[model samples]
Target: MANYLLIAASSDIGGATARRLRDGGHHVITTARDASVIDPDVVLDATDFDAVDRVVAEAGDLDGIAVFAGSMLLKPAHLISRAQYDETIAASLTTSFAVVRAAGKHLRNGGSVVLSSSAVALAGLSNHDAIAAAKAGVIGLALSAAASYASHGLRVNAVAPGLVQTRLTEGLTSSDMSRKVSEAMHPLGRLGEPEDIARAVEFLLDPANDWITGQVLGVDGGLGALRPRQRV
Candidate 1:
């Protein structure tokens, strides 16, 4: 059985991914900022590089690591406050970097690293300024880290998900009108579930998919690449 680390295990997608890994008979170590939530193996601030390094070091030979630390902010760039932008960047981009850095230093050869990005990072979406920027940084960081660590046999990839039905996104999906509008944006005609993205993360983390690296897997229900057809 392989060993894996999941940062921010309290998040919906993170919890789903952890369950998937454990069900496959792999050893999973989980972390979250809040100890009461999810009762993770570690209470961690994933954006803190020193804390991330310590976790990786203690894990003792990890096969894979995935960072699910992120946030959602739907506000225009012009209206976004300085603190909001900083928080967004720290949550997603900074946390991703911390994981990648730790993985590079500690993960075993041929190990995998998965990061969470967003469809808005690749496709244009209104009122997603702060989050889009942060997730976009994650993509760039993943690609570069993949390149840098390729020589050491480490694989790095990012999963970009579209609108997902989770506690974090309840504000956007709780209303019928908002839900329909969001669903209509995806060519698949539905919002993504946490399991959907979890499956993608599982795929990337599996040793069977070792050939894949430096790739951004879009788990966005066709939202990142396709334009939905007009309804008559």
Candidate 2:
């Protein structure tokens, strides 16, 4: 069985991805900021480069790495404080950067790397300025890393999800009215499930799909690409 490292395995996407990878007969090593009920194999903050590198080194060589560590901030651009803005970037964009950097140095040649982006990066939405900017940075980072690692046969890609029902978005989906609005915003008429994003990550990490790289796969429920019918 091939070995893989999943950073932020405590999150919804991370937890689901771990189960999927393990059930596929692969060895999965998980990391999170703390060892809570999720029971991560390793506990380290993804934003800390030294901590990330140390844990990755200890995981030994990995066939692939999936970085699913991030948080969501839902507020008007004017309402968000400067400190909160920095926190958003640290949690979402910087964390992804750290994972890719560590993976670049430690992953076995020809290994694949997958990171998370968001549907907001592709389509504009009110109160998503902070997150949209961060996810957009993730896309750029993944593409550049893909080029830098291409000579080593290493592949890098990203998955941009739309309104997934995870802890990160519970606030937005908790109420019936809000949930309905969210569902309506997507062409699929529903918010995404953690498994939806997990499956996309699984596909990108598969060695059989080695020919694919440097691509951002939108796993959103057509929220980023489609428009609802309007009376003409």
Candidate 3:
């Protein structure tokens, strides 16, 4: 079994990933900001670099680390408040940077690191300006970290997922009409499930995929590559 550390384990994707890894005979150490909702091995905000370092120090000899911390804010660029922008960036890009930096320093040689991105970052979508920018920053962080740590045999990569059906997206997909619209927006004609992204994350975390590094694998249900079908 391989040892792994997961930051922000309270999210739907993080929880699903933890279960998948554990079921695969891997040991996972989880961290969460809210200890009440999800009991984690470590209770610390990943946005704090010092806290990330402390958690990784305690997680010792980890083979992989995945940062699943992120926030979704659907607002036009002109309407996004300063507070909203700050919060979104802190939740997405800032936390990602902290996790990747700490992992580069703490993870054992030949270990892997996985960060989260979004399909909106790769392809523009309406009212997603704030989130798109932040997630794009995550892609940059992953690529830079991968280059910085490659000599040590460490690999860093990212997963860019489309509209996954999770608590994070419940507000956008709760109603029947809204759900239909979301599904139609994807070329697959269905919204992505948390498990789908979880599986992609697992692949990157697997030590056997050591050759893959500095790549942003899109697990976006073909949304990133194909446009939505045109109405007749």
Candidate 4:
């Protein structure tokens, strides 16, 4: 069984992914800003490299690190101030870098680094500018890390999700029109669930995935390839 350093386990996708790994017999050390909500062995602020290093030291040995700690900010271009945009970027991209750096220190020689991206990385979406840009960078970071860490026997990969029902998407809600439109955009005709992305992550983090690295796998129901206009 693997020992996982799970970041942001309080988030919808993060918590679900943590449970998924645990259900499959992995031990998870989680962290969120609020350590009391859930039992994260230590408190961590992904944006702070020093804090991340401190927590990694506390987690002892880890087989993998899942960087699923992120936030969503939907706003028009003009409305997106520098601070707001910086916050989003820090959460999605900067935190990822911190996690990778920490993993390089705490994870096992053949450990896994799993990060979360969004379909926006490859597609167009309104009000998603900040989040999308950060996620696109995430894809790049994962690949670069994969290359840099190969000699150390570490694997780096990313999973881009589309329209998963989570607190981040509360604005999208359960509207039938939004659901139908979004689902129709995907060739699979459905929105994603937490488990969908979670399973993909688990597969990539599995020891068997040692051969797979520096790849960005889409869990977006084919939105990256299909005609999204049909849904409109």
Candidate 5:
């Protein structure tokens, strides 16, 4: 079975992804700042530079890497200060960069890296300035990052999820109006589940997917494609 390095293992998406990999019999070394949030064999936050290095050091020769580290704080453009934007970038975008850099030495040749993005990167949304910017950078970083690691037969790609059911979206769960709005936003008439994105992550991480690199797959319940259009 393949081994995986799962950053943000404590997050709902990260945890679900990790569980999927584990249940499929792949070994996984997972990490998050709070050990209490994850039952992983190891715990470290990607945002913590030195701790992240240590975690990678301990988990050697991984077959794949899944970066699910992220945060969400919606606010009007005018209300989003530079410092807040930087924080979101650091947590959602910068952390992935650092994890990739750390994993390079341990990621086996021909292995893949999956970075998380959001459908917001392409679809317009209110109060999504910071996250959209960061996720967009993730899409941009994919090809360049793939280029840097191609010598080692490494592939990099990003997944842009839309309205997935997760802790990050717990607030929306309680609001029927919000849920209805979300459902209507996707032509599928439903929100994305964690498994939807998790399955996509699995495909991108599969070694057989060598030909598919430096791409962004939108696992957004048709939000990016069918949104802005009424479906009959």
Candidate 6:
């Protein structure tokens, strides 16, 4: 059983990943901003570098760490306010950097670090400027960190998921028209579930798959790489 830390466990994807890891007999230490919700081992604002360091310090001899802290902002670049853009970056890219920094200092050699990116980062989608930029940064960070940590046998990778059905996407999925549009965008003809992304994360975290590093696994139901077939 490997010891792992999951930041922002209150989020749907985070919770699912934590559960999946635990079910596989791994010891998962979870953290979230709200302690009342998921009862995580730590109540953390993942964007805070110092707080992230503290959590990493406490999780001794971890085999892996996954940062599931992120935000979704569907707005055109021209329409997005400075505050919204900053918040989006802080929630995703900044939080991811915090995890990377903490893991670099405290994680055991040969450990894994998995970060959350988005399909929008790989595929150009309308009204996704803020989130796309932030997630793209996550990809860059993961690749560079992977290179830096390779000598130590550490692996750094990311999962770029399509629109998964979660609270963060309730506004889009709850509406029939919006949901249909989103479903059609993915060649798979449906939206992704939290489990989809969780499985990818679990795959990247598995020590058996240690050969993989610096790659962005797209758990996006083909959204990032495929176009839907035209109906006759």
Best by TM-score: 1
For residues 7-73, write the lDDT of model 6, one tens digit per residue.
8889899999998988898899999988877898888899899999988998889999998888878
On the 0 to 100 scale, the lDDT of residue 110 in model 5 is: 61
lDDT of 5: 0.83
Which model is ahead, 1 or 6, in terms of TM-score? 1
The per-prediction tally of clashing pairs is 0, 0, 0, 0, 0, 0
Compared with the true structure, model 4 gives a TM-score of 0.93
RMSD of each: 0.8, 1.4, 1.1, 1.9, 1.7, 1.0
Model 3, 1-232: lDDT tens digits are 9999999989999999999999999999999997986989888888999989888888889999999989988889999999999999999899989888788788757799899999999887999999999999999999998999999999999999989999889998999999999888888788999899999999999988889999999998787778765765
Q: Please, what is the whole-model Cα lDDT of each candidate in the order they appear?
A: 0.93, 0.89, 0.91, 0.84, 0.83, 0.92
Question: Which residue pairs of candidate 1 clash?
Answer: none
The candidate maximizing lDDT is 1
Error of 6 at 61 (Å): 0.5
Quick one: ranking by lDDT, best first?
1, 6, 3, 2, 4, 5
lDDT of 4 by residue, 184-208 (tens): 7678887888889888888888887
How many clashes (backbone atoms < 3 Å, residues ≥3 apart in a chain or on different chains) does model 1 have?
0
Candidate number with the higher lDDT (1 or 5)? 1
lDDT of 1 by residue, 64-161 (tens): 99889999889999999999999999999999999998888887576999999999999999999899999999999999999999999899999999
lDDT of 5 at 96: 84
How displaced is residue 75 in candidate 3, in Å? 0.7
lDDT of 1: 0.93
